[model samples]
Target: MRLEQITYFLSVAEHGNITAAAKSLYISQPALSKQITLLEQEVGLPLFERQARGVVLTQAGVQFQKDLQNILKELEHAKKNAVLAGRAQKPLLNIGCFDGSYADDFLPSVYDYLKEAASGQKLVIHKCNFLEGHEYLEKGKIDLWLTLAPSWQDRPGFLKKKIAWRKGALIYSEKLQVGKKENPTWEDFKDETCVLVKKSQNPGMFQHTLDTMELIRLDEGTIEVVENIGTQISYVKLGRGYCFLSENIIHGSKGLRCISLPGERGIEVVAVWSEKNAAVTNLMENYPI
Candidate 1:
């Protein structure tokens, strides 16, 4: 019937003795008995059977006690969750990855460090469009963005950090003989077309390929393919063209050589975050390379 009455009844049911329940509740025996009697009257049923030494629960009392215990546990749990929700503390870190596979090798190490650094912080990486990078961070859709370098460079109100410059190598068949690996040059690739993956298929990978094209300042034309990586490799093996691939990408693949270029050229990778997001900014600064 009432909160106090419910508590008093539970106490007596637990001890099965009015004297013991009253002593535990810091109340007189008569007071505890009167509260139990009122609770039984409100419920229109007897909850306990009087015995010489202690009280025994009635059939209704047994069911009522089980239900009351369950209800009280649920109420306590709800109150705890309500307090947490009111605080508005979201310990989440969402990352917009230009290409998850591009950074897959290093992402785990980064995740390990963040987990060790802030055990409560949750990290999530979602593949995102390279072109819509600014909007992702601006709209708070992502806490941080990992994209090709210079995309966020020169932009005000944003902080940029170079995460990687993947080692670049030329992937081609032995038939071309463009240039020796010992003395690689743009002139070797001159007049030769490069095969690239299409953005429609993999936007992030397409952007990385474009970055490679831009880095070498190749004036040559490009052939775009869709659906799979084999298409690009096939072009090279068939002597159709050469495609620039990151060293890791070309490694362990058959029918092609990963030629190391002479000059310092690579797919520049960077992490972008808004300066206004102090929490994210701090995370980016301390993030392991």
Candidate 2:
């Protein structure tokens, strides 16, 4: 199938509705549907089972989606490698990190280690969200991933080490007064609702939230769940509920009060990398993480 057909198919699968997918992609619904039809004809299989409300992936569609995702990641790596080779740049090590300074303390030392020891090696940082970074690490697009733990992203052939630890952030509406304490406990949040991002969007963060809440003895009387960060933050701004985020990224915003939520189970900044990298020995040897 053509690349555009593949892209359209993925969007339709993600939205689970042709019309919604078309709107999201800024294309006409008829055009998108025609592409899907052509793709299905070429594949000789129905990818999605049509439904009254929307559509659902058939078993074959699920497998195809997973395979296509990996193929795309590998394709990206191939493109980057060709360009880097053409430029005759230094040997590259791609580092994927969550978009924040949480892991900044450990990076300077890593930089020093590379500068003093492996001077020929080049380091490139890819700032990404949890899912993007996780996907990059899995696909070998990145040599390393720095993120918050406990990482629920358990997979074989990958190694993880705790690089550092920090407090988590409590996000709430500025109008609400939980107390004057520097760090607010779950007791202060007992009467209010807690907002959570959908587990499917960020499984690691979802599991971490549950784990941290359990550790801090949260007694949430109400709960609201949203699809993503933007919607989650909207709920908080509307005073619907409070949520927790990574410490380093959560400086209080215009309408939100983001503060330390330190407790027994605090944030663990972690470094995850594939076990098969050439520089694995040097990385593991020179640094604790």
Best by TM-score: 2
Candidate 1 backbone overlaps, count = 0
lDDT of each: 0.71, 0.74
Q: Could you tell me every candidate's TM-score relative to the true structure?
A: 0.52, 0.66
- Pairing residues by index, what is the TM-score of model 1? 0.52
TM-score of 2: 0.66
After superposition, candidate 1 runs with Cα above 4 Å error: 1-90, 173-192, 197-218, 225-240
**True lDDT of residue 174, candidate 2:** 55
- Residue 270 of candidate 1: its Cα lDDT? 78
Instruction: Mark the regions of model 2 whose C-alpha exceeds 4 Å error after superposition.
Output: 7-36, 45-74, 99-117, 128-139, 152-158, 175-185, 200-205, 215-217, 226-240, 262-264, 275-278
Model 2 has an lDDT value of 0.74
